[model samples]
Target: MNQELSESLDKSCKDLYKEETKYFDYIKKIKETAPNLKNYKTNKSKKIDQAFESILSYHEEAREVIQRKIRYANEGLKTTNLLIKKYVQQELISKLPGWEGSSNPPPLCGKIPANNNYIASNGDLVAASIPDENTGSAIILCHVKTYSKTTQEYKLVDFFEDLNKGPSYYTLPKEDVIPIPRTLSSKHLSQTEFSKNEKVLAVYPETTTFYPAIVLESPGSRTKKGFDTFYYSLRFVNDFVEQIEVYARFVIPNNEK
Candidate 1:
């Protein structure tokens, strides 16, 4: 039985190697094709740009898929090694009592179970600050997913509120406020998640002293697609300030299960 299992494991490893080699060859072909595609002249710059963008996007997605496959293969190799050492050898298996197998935590942030649905709905929150001379203001930007058939474009909401809740609440009328439309470039479209870039605005609004933070939420449709939500908080403070802190929480429907 042990010998059969070892042979099976060896075959799996060989199959994985072949798959890896195929993926590497595909990547090389993509790299070789990129320069030729770039040199092709077209009358319409917009059409050319769009075509190039699609190619890049396909390349990126394919790369991610290949990487995930490689990761799975490596994990399988580790599991096979532990199984052989324990069951086949028998020496190590007798010494350790109640040892099921060698356990490994998740790749990111330890063994915390991630909420994929939330990530799909609310894109991601990113914050940054702009400081010039004696004056500077913090910005909190939320990238809300509006990619469904019902919705047209992504929405970014900026808030000027205290990081720590106080009695005073900053309020601005919707009509009075004007939000600058942020253009999406090819680089921005490639990312599965959203991240805001810091910019120094000409006019700083008058508001109470407050740290900045952002909350990202995906659309309801995206949650149904099984993508975990991502949330991030950032605080910008002057060099003189002592403590800077932020916290975030999310609620999802059908969360009882």
Candidate 2:
């Protein structure tokens, strides 16, 4: 019976230790990925806090168990507990400063619509700060699903874990969103180079994909005559959808590619 109990205790300690190790590694990643932790509070940090709290509690319980074993003069249990303490103090505690620094959490969602079109009503992507099952928090973004102009309510699009593959229809609240901005080129397009009925490549806002389009109107629909840079309304070749308006800089001349 004593041997069985000892084995069980050892297994439990090792399992908890492994979990703590993962927490420590995650903290390191946060430090590298989110250096200005003070500016961006997020559910990710909250999960880190939960993990830290669990570690502290586990350490305390292990200490009590060790003390009991020592009082009974159980050499094996005493040694095992000492090792656990060493791992907690050395490996886990040493890396906690990085985690402690990430105090600011991200907002629940953005108040305005994201400036780009990749975020369609059902196409925009998003990432939650923590795992889905956990009740922590998340950030949001989009275009078609755009900001609810009438309501100011934003949908949680997806989780950060799936940022690589892309996100589908997942609605989150306004406070839990982080808008991902699209990068625009600094070089402006020349006005004379574009003309009506000219075939060119235009950026499709829905997926950021560039497709062949015919220029239906010069100075794209969004561009004003006096503006140095303008937008153009384009009819994508073979597209059954409505004409899309795009910035001059985003339109690529088919020859350039």
Candidate 3:
């Protein structure tokens, strides 16, 4: 009886080892072929599309995970203020990015109603006209509002370190930099004056009282030649405000030369 039991145990051990080796080999093969996998090959445009898709996917997944955790924790719990505080601390607060404290909330800002218009201008040598006659341009209006314990200020920064770094004339990818029409000279508009233009439609505060409302627009869209416009927004959270909210819109033209 003892000999038979020992033989059975030895066979089981050998079988387990064989299974483990098979799985290990399988994993090794996958890793070796991963780089050459057909699915990984993509054109530049497809890569960009994939990147954007990935960003959206991650955003959605994170949101769902946060909500699910919050719901699970709050199940059957009392709706008291203390319970609310505990649930947020245990589930939601840390999951959020850039969330410093309950006092400081993340700002929400995005393009509002999309507007596409057609405007024609003679290629002029003025501060607000396109440089070339053949190429057409339009204005883009973007607005941002932030509410929090801190006041927010917006500004556009030069994406390129310096013109001398590369060719003076070059076309930048729309994703790499904000599009600003070259027809309009950056020097022409003071920060405040630029912020307030007739093209400026409406600006309103968001639901959060702490967030301030903002409206911004660029005079044109990006083209093969170059971006007719270049602009960016800088939000400064006031020392007093803990949370910031932002909303904006970009006015693009219907056609581009």
Candidate 4:
């Protein structure tokens, strides 16, 4: 179903492009014909009048075709968005802890949402306010999994350090945790701005999790929201010779004092 919707969207886009091309061609004809009839001195008056009529006809026809194509394109876009949203919600439900599938489970993958004042479901990554290091006045990334819904409590932290005992979940309230931002979902949890040679944590060739890394070059993007919307080259901290290009969204701050 998703594939069919995607193909429909592609065809709709192509049709819109064809309509736009036709509109441009009509405009080009008007421009070419108008310049040739300068003051009607060299050209016959009947010819000039006929040329004006042709230009007006082309303009009206282009407007009609373009408007019709735009309406069709909008309907296609709306259907595509609705289907995609449905699939995403279904996938999110499958990723929740203790979720069981009918025959096959939906694939679980996506960026964890950022902080917001609401109840986060199980499988969410969040930030727990802890004292400096142990929770006096510090913070760390955690994963949310409901151990007891009646008490409004959860087990946070689903990751582990390298060579550790693997990931585990600890207990905390939904109120104590802030859902981490998607920008920080796969990042090192540092400040937003990263300069050249600045220290950072980045996901590997992919975004499973963040590892210690350093920025290697200038950030690049179309707009002014640098780290929030840029790409940077980075080198991992533990490894010596494995540099990778990462989107700014995947680059994050290391939990430093």
Candidate 5:
């Protein structure tokens, strides 16, 4: 069990520290690039600034938040190590010979193996996005499980609300959609057609899929090269709650498509 505790501690802290590094990198990137865009004549530049403002506004605040999380995770690791040592030295040593005689069973005592190759009901950790009902797109942790005798499905909790309160559910195969709504016209709608709160189909990054989303902001228009373009901020339709920045060509009107 000490090994398991150690492994879990390492996994949790490793991820937290990784995230802390990412936050610092993000802050650094913002500092390095955001100010340089001040003189640019594009509305997209303003959008970039606005997009990072909330994060950049309180650099100290962001640092404090990330530092607090790192500190908490470190403290947790220390506590886990102390507890593991206390149990082994103070209690388990005397009871190991007569293991069945203890009134309370020791948790994690030879119950979970330290070998990482063993696949539990949940498979390896994977990066995934889920369809969100309330917020559009939601990022979630999932365990890949055999949905049937042959098919594999991800066992995940709903990303919204209290995830621990509900029964476990599996991701369906059909949810991995390439949303090609055939209702749309061949010519894309202009940026002027998109309005705030309008439901539209927009492209998800790095996927051929288009997701239903709501337009959060249409931050005016800008002319580039010989043509005009518009930038939009969108929140996805289902479990994906992450806000995305999209060009006008990517934001399809609900009436047309």
Candidate 6:
């Protein structure tokens, strides 16, 4: 509704400006044809100026209203994210291997595993922040292909993808790897259920195949444009930030291929 209203207001402003121009042209004719009524043109111009000022003021107020709505929406989003973080820390990751209700919790504060024992095992899904010239450094979702305890390095493969694919292999440091829970379900990571920077496979527009992406805004309607559509504001692994909006249905948890 806000989008439609904004467009309509803009159209009206243009139409009014066109008519205002025509009015000045009409009065200019009177000035040219009769020199005695110069005061009339001056008074008419003042009235037009007043009307234009009112229109300008109206535009400013409308802009302020939109900005206020944006501020409110952002505040709500911040609160929602805080709640998701708390829930994930309590429910999701808390159930992972090393976090078996132990006194010493897993390394979640910085998201790096403290040691080999704290890290996930082979075939466990993880979000690896590996970057290459092509992928542009966004976190790509993958499953642990292998890990070297001595080197503290992990070999990750794109989640459920073919192992023969050369690009699918991701070698990440212990610090860049985030282990995902083996029991985490699709429902826990869907839309508003997703946490900030959560690993995901979102469908690229006009394609059925899900690709690697990270969550920027979960259940996000591309809110930058004041939209409330069913879209996940995502950044595909290949690009830094571009026109990427995957429908909610197309966005799924990292475990799914």
Give the candidate number with the greatest TM-score.
4
Write the number of the candidate with greater TM-score, choosing between 3 and 5.
5
Model 6, 122-234: lDDT tens digits are: 87656666675875765545778788888889988864233211226877788777654342222222313355678876656533235778877754324446654445678
TM-score of each: 0.23, 0.26, 0.16, 0.32, 0.26, 0.31
lDDT of each: 0.33, 0.46, 0.29, 0.53, 0.47, 0.55
Candidate 5 lDDT, 96-180, residue by residue in tens: 3312322333321221112232222443322235667987864443435433324534354322111222335546552331112
Per-residue alpha-carbon lDDT of model 1 for 1-257, expressed as tens digits?
A: 23455457567666766676676666557655655686455576557567666766676676677667667756875665455323422331133222122333221111122333222233332222323255553333333323333333333333221111111222222222222222111111212222332211211112212233221322122234543222222223232433221211211111111
Stretches of candidate 5 exceeding 4 Å from the true structure: 23-27, 34-51, 57-63, 89-257
Q: Runs in model 3 with CA error above 4 Å?
A: 41-257
TM-score of candidate 6 to 2 decimals = 0.31
Q: How far is candidate 4 from the true structure (C-alpha RMSD, Å)?
A: 19.5
What TM-score does candidate 5 reach?
Answer: 0.26
* Residue 155, model 6: Cα distance from true site in angstroms: 5.8
RMSD for all candidates, in order, please.
Answer: 27.6, 26.5, 26.4, 19.5, 27.8, 17.6
Better model by lDDT: candidate 1 vs candidate 2: 2
C-alpha RMSD in Å of predicted model 6 compared with the true structure:
17.6
True lDDT of residue 191, candidate 3: 23
- lDDT agreement of model 1 with the native: 0.33
Instruction: Estimate candidate 3's alpha-carbon lDDT, on a 0 to 1 scale.
Output: 0.29
Leading candidate by lDDT: 6
Error of 5 at 30 (Å): 4.6
Q: Is candidate 4 or candidate 5 better by lDDT?
A: 4
Q: For model 3, how many clashes?
A: 44
Which digits, one per residue and each the tens of the lDDT, describe model 2 over residues 108-142? 11111344432224344332232345534322222
